[model samples]
Target: MSRADAYHKMLMSVSHFQHNIALILEAKALEASRSSQWLCHHLSAAQFGQNHGEQVKRSVEIHDHVLDVIDGLTKMEQALAKNMQALLGEPEAPDSGSLGDMLPLGGN
Candidate 1:
């Protein structure tokens, strides 16, 4: 494909990735809030329950990890989008840059 075509396709891919990451981030935020509320409501019970301490800790940790992952993805998506914008003028480097091997538009 031509350089212009590749650039346009990469832009489209970045836009799609941005939308997907936004939705995922929203979902993660909602889940984190819900889990936080649940923990607040059952803090005492979870801490003192006969056999729920570990479960509570694990559940909270899972939610926290999810939030971390969401944040990482958000940052990655933003960086990729910026690169995409830069490539608008440069038509991106293919078959050379390390990212070209992993990104959708980078595949040959």
Candidate 2:
């Protein structure tokens, strides 16, 4: 294949990669929000007590774990973007507010 054709294919692949990443991020955010809402509703239904406190603690731990998984996904996305940039002989784009920045957990 010609260089131009190869370059075009690479760009197409990168575009698809970006689109898929966006979808994954959106799905994860929705799941996290649903989980948080469900936890809040249940917690409110139950009367406050030692058991409630323990439940809240466990809920927080689970949320933290989910956030960590999200962070890992974000990192993988960034790495893929950088790899695509390199493959296309393009410079890294300057820092901008990414989807990760919009996360309530601050993408940490």
Q: Pick the candidate with the highest TM-score.
A: 2
lDDT of each model, Cα atoms only? Answer: 0.73, 0.75
Which candidate leads the pack in lDDT? 2
- What's the C-alpha lDDT at position 22 in model 2? 88
Model 1 quality (TM-score): 0.53
* lDDT against true structure, model 2: 0.75
Alpha-carbon shift of residue 57 in model 2 (angstroms): 3.1
lDDT: worst 10-residue window of model 2: 99-108
Residues 1-108 of candidate 1: C-alpha lDDT, one tens digit per residue: 998798789878878977997787798779879978987887775465677767778778877987888688867965885696578655654464345445554354
Give the TM-score of each candidate: 0.53, 0.65
Q: Model 2: how far is 94 from its true place, Å?
A: 11
Candidate 2 deviant stretches above 4 angstroms:
45-56, 91-108
